[model samples]
Target chain A: MQAKRVTFPNKVLPYLLLAPQLAVTAVFFLWPAGEALLGALYAEDAFGLSRQFVGLENFAALARDPAYLEAVGVTFLFSGAVAGLSLALGLLLALAAEKAGRLAGLYRTLLIWPYAVAPAVAAILFWFMFDPNVGVAARALRGLGVTWNHFLDGRQALLLVVLAAAWKQVSYNLLFFYAGLRAIPRPLIEAAALDGAGPVRRFTAIVFPLLAPTTVFLVVVNVTYAFFDTFGIIHATTGGGPGRATTTLVYKVFKDGFEGLDLGSSSAQSVVLLAIVAALTVLQFRHIERKVQY
Target chain B: MARRDGMVERDGALTLAAHGVLILGVAVMVLPVYLAFVASTHPGADFLGGRIGVLPGPDGPANYAALVGLGAPPPGVPPIGPMLWNSFVMALGIAVGKIAISLLSAFAVSYFRFPFRVTAFWLIFITLMLPVEVRILPTYKVVADLALLNTPGGLILPLIASATATFLFRQVFMTIPDEMTEAARMDGAGPMRFFWHILLPLSRTNIAALFVILFIYGWNQYLWPLMVTTEASHATIVTSIQRLAATANQEAPVWHLVMGTAILALLPPVAVILAMQRLFVDGLTETEK
Candidate 1:
């Protein structure tokens, strides 16, 4: 909130400067959010002609709905897999690149381009590779006597989505992890090396511990990504199919609201998603504040 | 000398292992796209049965030409050419719009004191909590009411108020020494003039860096464009690929054309990130921090 010690002495100009951003935010963001909050409390008839005040009934119904509960579970599983897979791969790759010395830059460039691929595009890339009929990866799996149809198998579909989501995310995680690795003081590793520690030992005792903050931050970020951003991934690849196995909360909100036209339930889900994001944003900022202090 | 030689001998193996890991890592990252590119070169019939080829086929130019000119198997799907243009316009609009508004707001917040300034800042800050996906329906209704649906303005405006970019500019502005402001004031450089000359020039790198990140963010946007722009004329390449894939799922899979479309859809953003590698890295690490 701090301002310059010397000031620009124009009240009207400052307001004018802030107007466009404020106007867009008010109309597109605040108003819609306000409507979602209010709509969560009311229900409309199937004809969209009559409305009745429901007073927490919608939220209560979501709490009892088996499908909603299943979605919550699925979201946790999906995000956990995404975060864990990407973080581990990122760290491993970062560590290797650090030691690869001269080849590091080339590897970084080659590896990081996937960060530019959209989640939906990433899904299709993998979807093509895993196509049941003629995909190279699917063919390889079949050669190994493993059935690999993401179309009919719920677990296979979930795995496909997870791989797609994690593949796109690994580049992001690697950048952070590589940066974190570079930030570690080199002499600390040299001193440890002088004391006769192996590579794995040195990583566990020094490199991994120093990178903990970066890892923590990426966990929150990757989870939020898997939750919200992968809506495109799920939509494009599976459409939450194989009997809703790949449907996360965000996908369900889209399905119920836009597709099914269950405004009340969708709005209730929106409120829930909003609360989750707010909490995650707060956690991210707090972590950032702590990182700033360090 | 003997101990150093022994150390070198041990380190040599470790370094080789490191190179091994990095090669594998890069291969894992790049293979899917490579496979996709190879598939795009083959005729669609090649993927009808049997295993897909690992190498590029003879049909690359024809497949790409057809996609560029005529689009894919889905009868009504927009051509890759127009969708790419729409994607470009939407991405450029979002990036430029966000940067312009954010710079102005950050300049106001950082350089001036006004009533409700804190309130204005928080109002923008609250947007970080409500992504478009969370408030999909009501936001859709607002656009529909405005009759902005299926328009470029509809695609760009609703998404352009960026709290992250605003905060990034504010952070950049805070680092400017107060004496610079005082010097500009003493020279009678009015606020806007000083902003145009001094502040703007000084923040060029930051601006470029932010542009890289925001450009990618805008280009990669899927769910918003998918929901807002129903008409194929306004459809972005990203969403169009999804539509194409969906149709391919139902009918004979047009793997060649679909892969070609996917490659085209991803190329611009990937090219941006690679070309602006340094700025992209700085923008990402700094903004995230």
Candidate 2:
């Protein structure tokens, strides 16, 4: 909120500059969010003929709805898996790259471009790779005496979507993790080494502890990513699945609203999602606040 | 002498292990695209023949040709040419629109004192938490009511109203020394003039870095464009790639050409990342900071 020491006195010019952004926020972000909250309280007839105010009916129905519950469970499982796998792999790769000497830059380039690939496109690449009939990976799995068909098997479908989502995210995690590693002071590592500690001991005692802040930041980011960004992966590959097996909460919102034409329930779900995001944002900001204090 | 030799041996082994792991990581990341590219080059029957070949084949040119409009339109899917154009336009619009509005707003909030400025900043900050996915229903309704369906403006505008770029620019502007502004004012420069001449040039790298990020964000949009653009003409390459995969020729789902389109869909954004690696990395780390 701090302004320049020598500031501009023209109020009208400031308002003019702020107008476009304010207008867009009001119409697109603020208005839709308000509507979602308001619309969640009402129920409309399926035929678009009638409407009635049902204060918490939508919420109650969502509670009882088995599919909604399933979607919630799946979202937790998917996000936990994506965040855990991506973070671990990213940390490993970052450590390796740090020790890789001259080849580090090449590996970084090869590893990072996937972050730019669309999640939908990433899903397609994996979809083709694991397709039952023509997919080489599928054939390889079959050769090892395992059945592989996401199109028919729900668990397989969930695994496919998880892998694709995690694959797309690994690049992002690697960048942050590597940057975090680079920020660690070198003398500490050398001192630990001079104490006769091996590489693993050095990492556990020194590097890992130092990377804690970065790891925490990446955790919040990865969870938010797995929760929202994987909509593309689900939509492109599984379409929420052979039987809603891979349907995360965000996917369920789109399906229920757009595909099912159940607007009231969808809006209620939207409100629920908005609340979750607001909570996550608060968490991230709290971390930022702490960082600033330091 | 023995201790020195042992230390040298350990260093050599450690370096070798590091190289091994990094290479494996790179391979894991790249192998899927490599296989997809190989699949793109092979004949359709080769994929359907069970167990795809691992190397490039003779069909690359033909498959790409059919995709980019040298051949008949594949059944139920449009050619990739128009869709690519649409994606380009939408991405460009989003990058430019976001930069223009965000730069102005950041300038306003950081440089001028005004009523409700903190409230405005907080309002924009709130949008950071609510992605378009969470509020799809009502937002779609708003777009439909505005008759923006099947139009590029609808696809570009709502998504561009992001606080990420605005917050990024604000952070950049804060780090700029106030002496620059004071000097400009003493030189008889107006606020807009200073912004146009001094501030704009100074933030060129930030702008370029942001452009790379926003362009990718816009180009890779799936759900919003999927909801809004129903017409084939307005279809983006990312959305259209989904359509292509979902509606492949009934019997076998033409894996060859679908892979080709997939490659096309990924190329531009990947090229941007590779071309501007330094700026992209700086922008990414800076924004998150």
Candidate 3:
């Protein structure tokens, strides 16, 4: 909220400066959000003839809907797996890179560029490797006696999407973890080292504890990422499934709205997503404030 | 000296372990793309039920030539050229547009005190909570109502209002000493003049960093583009890859061309990130913070 001490003393100029952003936000963001809130309360009849005001009916239906419940479960599982896998790998790589000496820069460069790869593109890359027929990884798996057809197996489909999603995310998490690691004071690690603690012990005792804020921040980020951003990955690779196995909440919203034409239900789902995102954004900002204090 | 030598030996062993882990990590990171690249170089028939080789094949030039020049071998899949151009334009538009609006808004909020300034800031800040995914139907409706569907404006305009960039600029502006503004005023440098001459140069690094991040964001957009552009002409490379892959999935499975498209789709953003890595990192951390 801090502003410059000196005033510009030009009210008209300030409004002019703010106009474009405000106009865009109003049109693209605020209006649509308002419509979503209103639309969630009304049910449109078949053939788009008339709409009925259905108070909380859409939300009630979602709560009881088995498919929606399944999506909720899938989302949690997918997000948890992606976050856990990516965070652990990111931390491990960051720790190793810290000790890599001259090779650290090269390793960082190689590891981080994947951050720029689109989630959908990342899904494609992994899909090629994990395709049921003629896939190298699938062949290797089949050779090991594990059936790896994501097309038929629901769990395998989920796993494939998870891998694709997590693979793309690891680089982002690594960059943050590496920056967090670099910010940790060196002497603290050296002091722990002088006390005869090995690298593993030092990491568990000192380094890991200090990286807690970063880890927490990344957990929220990674979860939010897996929730919202991985829509592309799921859409491109599995198309939400071997049945509805890979159907996430966001994907379901898209399916129900665009494909199913369940406008009321989709709007209700949008409201739900909006609430979830608002909560996450608030949590993120609070953590950012805490991080600043640290 | 003997104890020091022993410590040195231990450190060397640890460093070796570190190198081992980093090498494995790098391999895991690069393997998929390498495999994809290798797959792209092979003849389409090679993937018709056999183990895929790890090495690049002789068909690299032919596959890429067909992909880049003739589009996918499939009947409906559009050429890579137009899709790539669409992606480039959309990405550049989003990045430049977001930065332009955000820079001005942040400047207004930080440098001037006017009525409804707080209201304006909050309005923009609220956008952080309402991602396009959340309000997909209605946002699509708005764009459609505006008749922006399948146009560059449809792709870029809806996405250009950025709260993160605005906040980042505000954060940057806060660090600028008040004296700079005071001195500018004394020299009669108007608000716009001061912004162009002083603030713009001072924030050049932030802008570049932001541009890198936003360009990637814009290029990688999937759902928005998928919803907005039903036309192949306006289809971005990222969204088009999905369509191509879906088509291949149903038919004879042209793995070579699909992989080729994937490589082309990812190449520009990856190159930008690698080329301006430091800026990207700084932009990422600063914006998130």
Q: Candidate 2: where are CA atoms >4 Å away?
A: B1-10, B71-76
Candidate 2 chain B: worst-modelled 10 consecutive residues by lDDT: B1-10
Q: What is the lDDT of residue A102 in candidate 3?
A: 65
Q: Model 3's DockQ?
A: 0.64
Task: Tell me the spans in candidate 3 whose CA falls farther than 4 Å from its real position.
Answer: B1-10, B70-76
Cα lDDT for residue B164, candidate 1: 92
B130, model 3: CA deviation in Å?
A: 0.5
TM-score of 1: 0.97
Please give, for residues B165-223, the per-residue lDDT of candidate 1 as tens digits. Answer: 89999998989999999999999889999999999999999999999988899999999
For candidate 2, give the docking quality class from DockQ. Answer: medium
Summarize candidate 3's per-residue lDDT along A1-294 as a digit string, tens digits.
Answer: 767788698869998898899999999999999999999999997467899999999999999999999999999999999999999999888888877766788899999988899999999888888887878998899999998999899999999999988888888888899899888876777677778888779878988999999998999999999999999999998999989999999999999999999999999999999999999999999999898786
User: What pairs collide in candidate 1?
Assistant: none
Better of 2 and 3 by DockQ: 3
Models ranked on lDDT: 1, 3, 2
lDDT of all predictions: 0.90, 0.88, 0.90
Tens-place lDDT per residue, model 2, B173-200, is 8888989988998999999999999889
Poorly placed runs, candidate 1 (over 4 Å): B1-10, B70-77
> lDDT at A103 for candidate 2?
72
Which residue pairs in candidate 2 collide? none
